[model samples]
Target: ADGAAYERALERHAGLAKPPGSLGRLEDLGARLAAIAGRCPPPIPSSPAVVVAAADHGVHAQGVSDWPQEVTAAMVETVAAGGAAVNAIARTVGARVEVVDVGTLRLGPVPGGVHDERVRSGTRDLAVEPAMTIEECRAAIGAGARVAAELIDGGADLLVTGEVGIGNTTASAALIAAFTGAEPAEVTGKGANLDHERTPHKVEIVRTALARHAADTSVEARGSLGTLASLGGLEHAALVGVMLAGAAARIPVIVDGVITGAAALAAVALCPDVAGYLIAGHTSAEPGGRSLPDRLGEPALLDLRLRLGEGTGALLAVPLVQAAARVLTDMVTLADVTKTA
Candidate 1:
């Protein structure tokens, strides 16, 4: 972020007809956009696109989520067909939704428009073994970077992170605990209407995975990639790559729910600079999502108690993001409003 550009934006904000800080976070959001675009009045973000990265998690076998592993592939198909919540929200916001199959098990026929970049059919159960090989994890990250590049190259001015994978919240909780030093019980949440009776079991599963990768889980250990490879799902790794690419491109990437927040944890771990490029679209109902904004130094733009992981929450916040820049560019200045005495 450039300090000069930010100061210039603040100056412009003061010059606006409204009182200083009248718009609150909106004023701050505009200034940040100016810093991001390297100008006092940043260009309004247009042509937003949400990339839905889909995969199947081996943790599904651990009885963590009530939804079966097959639902991962089925929902990927729904996203590809533009039938999912992300699709409708993207449509409402005039953003395109791109579904990518990073890795899914038992996928019969992939619908058109969904890119096929499967790292593996599905990750191995993290409780018993590492979810993915180091190479596989790297490849998945590379795939996300490629997807971000393609979308930005295709004229997408902003990127939104979305993920679809059954049992992914288990992986997310484990990743959050690993990165934030939060207890598994504190970060874990009941996913997919998981019965209260089994929530503690899910927490234990995350604890087990974190314990298995204890050496690599510490932030000071400088083992972010190691931690991801050991416990992350393909979609999570890809989201990290996407975030890195967005930062490299200087495009804002709005993060979705707990699943996306987990990816963000890994991304910020790998490259702390990526934090400057991220936007917390909402505070997810999940405990992990609730804690992520503070870690990223950005407050959530909305709090819809959203728990869906298909980028739905992020997509809903697109208009607000666009509004921030629009206010800077379109609002009247005090000089314009006041006539000469």
Candidate 2:
């Protein structure tokens, strides 16, 4: 990304026919697009693609979420068949949807639309063991990077991160609490809008995971990768890979809700510059979702109390991102207005 291009975009915004700052954050968003694309008026992001990475968490056995782990595979099938909310939203937004089986525990026969690169059946029980070995974590990250590169090379101008795993929110909360030092109670939320009756148990699950991985919490000692390997879900690790690869490719990556937020924390921890490459699509109702923007220094574009994680929130914000870039390129300049006058 070109720092000079960003400055030039700000100048161009001031010269637009509309009153200065009329577009509010849209103007800033346009400038960021310019910086990322290295153009005064960045190309309107087209060929948008959303990757829904599916996996299972061994911690589901802890009774944190009422949703059975089998639902993860079922939802992956739903996504492949275009029956899910994300598929409908992606269709409406003219974005392509691809399901990636990174570490699903019991996926059935995969559809042609699904990408199969499973690192393992699913992650080990974080409550009892490390979610994955460091080697397994590296494999999942590598798989995510490869997927991102393939998508970009296949003409995807914009990318959105998504996920599907029945107990992922529990894993997401645990990862957030571990990295951010937020209490488990502070980060855990009503995942899948499950009954609040189980919230206490959920918090305790996260608390247990944190205690088990205590040595990995020291940033100087264990580092972000260690924290991620110790606490993150396979989907979360893969999302971090997608984010890092997107930044490397200089393509903007829109982050979804809490699951994606946990991934972004790990990604930024790995490479701080990746923060500049991210755009928060929406803040999930979950606590981590709300605090995520504060952690990344990038405010979300929307907040409609969305907690569905299959990239639905992020896909909804795609048109807004496109509009920002379009306005920069299509709107007339003050010089033109003065001439017409």
Candidate 3:
């Protein structure tokens, strides 16, 4: 059913006015997104929601990230104050930003518009222990799903998943490896500009954590919250739930960089069909991020050497998607292009 819907969607757009294939990949994005919604002129999500999940990670103590743990909360504050890149980009695209605090250890009042669903103080250090307790992980997933469902039910036609947490990318890469069965080195990256001196060390730390938990992860199934709790961040777990909800709601989700990608990978593992709702935003410059999902054949939309995990890349591609949707919706049929006798 999904494949057929996507096929006719592409066919309809390609048959629209203007030269065939003139609109390039955009026509494709629109057609696929529309098929996901199973509607012509699928809702453009006039007020698309960018759900930014913020949490702290004990892994930051492992020297995995160049920035301090405080940066996570500080940046969340900046995002709420409209000073972050996602804030600027979402504004340009007319999308609303909603920040969620899944497990910021020192959480206080978030901005009025942000959601506070703190499941725990923060995740445990993966280097010395699992990032989250199985129960905490479950709650985070439920929180994320609930957020996405609420946004969709409130008429958000599209959802862009984003995240913030200084050391969360380290958590994301670890999840990608354990879930995707890829090597830790293959999924780890130079997060937040880890100096050349520290990049390798950061990667090694992830490696050690993986080895210590090797038997546990191998024994776990990536298809449930337990798998996530064993090797993922609170934010990632929540994002995975959000993706699952978005898929069920027939909303297209623009996945951010490595962190968001990690969440999407877990979603795919949990519910393979949820991938239909995801649009690969861009290729992350994070070390092996580009190849993280080599098993999935679709290529990313952009590659401007971005390693940021703030969903900035997804926001950057929002216009392309909107433009594509416009093409499908506004284009006249080829038959209509001819004058009547």
lDDT (Cα, tens digit) per residue for candidate 1, span 1-341: 66688788888999898888898898888888787777878889999999999998888888887777888889988888888998889999999998889999973766678888888898999887789888899999999999999999999989999999988888999888888899999888887754666689989899888777774444432478988888889999999989998888888899988999989989999998888788899999988886669887777999999898899999998999899999888898888878643
The candidate with the higher TM-score, 2 or 3, is 2
lDDT of 3 by residue, 175-224 (tens): 77777778777777677864666767777877877776765644342345
Candidate with better lDDT, 1 vs 3: 1
TM-score of candidate 3 against the unseen true structure:
0.92
- The regions of model 2 sitting more than 4 angstroms off are 216-221
Candidate 2 collision pairs: none
Candidate 3, poorest ten consecutive residues by summed lDDT: 215-224
- Once superposed on the true structure, which residue ranges of model 3 sit more than 4 Å away at CA? 107-111, 217-224, 291-295
What is candidate 1's local distance difference test score? 0.87
Clashing pairs in 1: none
Q: Per-residue CA lDDT of candidate 2, range 1-341, in tens?
A: 67898999899999999999999989989888888888889899989999899999988888878877888888998999999999999999999998899988773666677898799988888887789888888888888888999999999888999999988888899888877888899989878855788888888888888888884544432778888887888998888889888898889999999999899888988888888788899999887896668886667999999888999999999999999999988999989999999
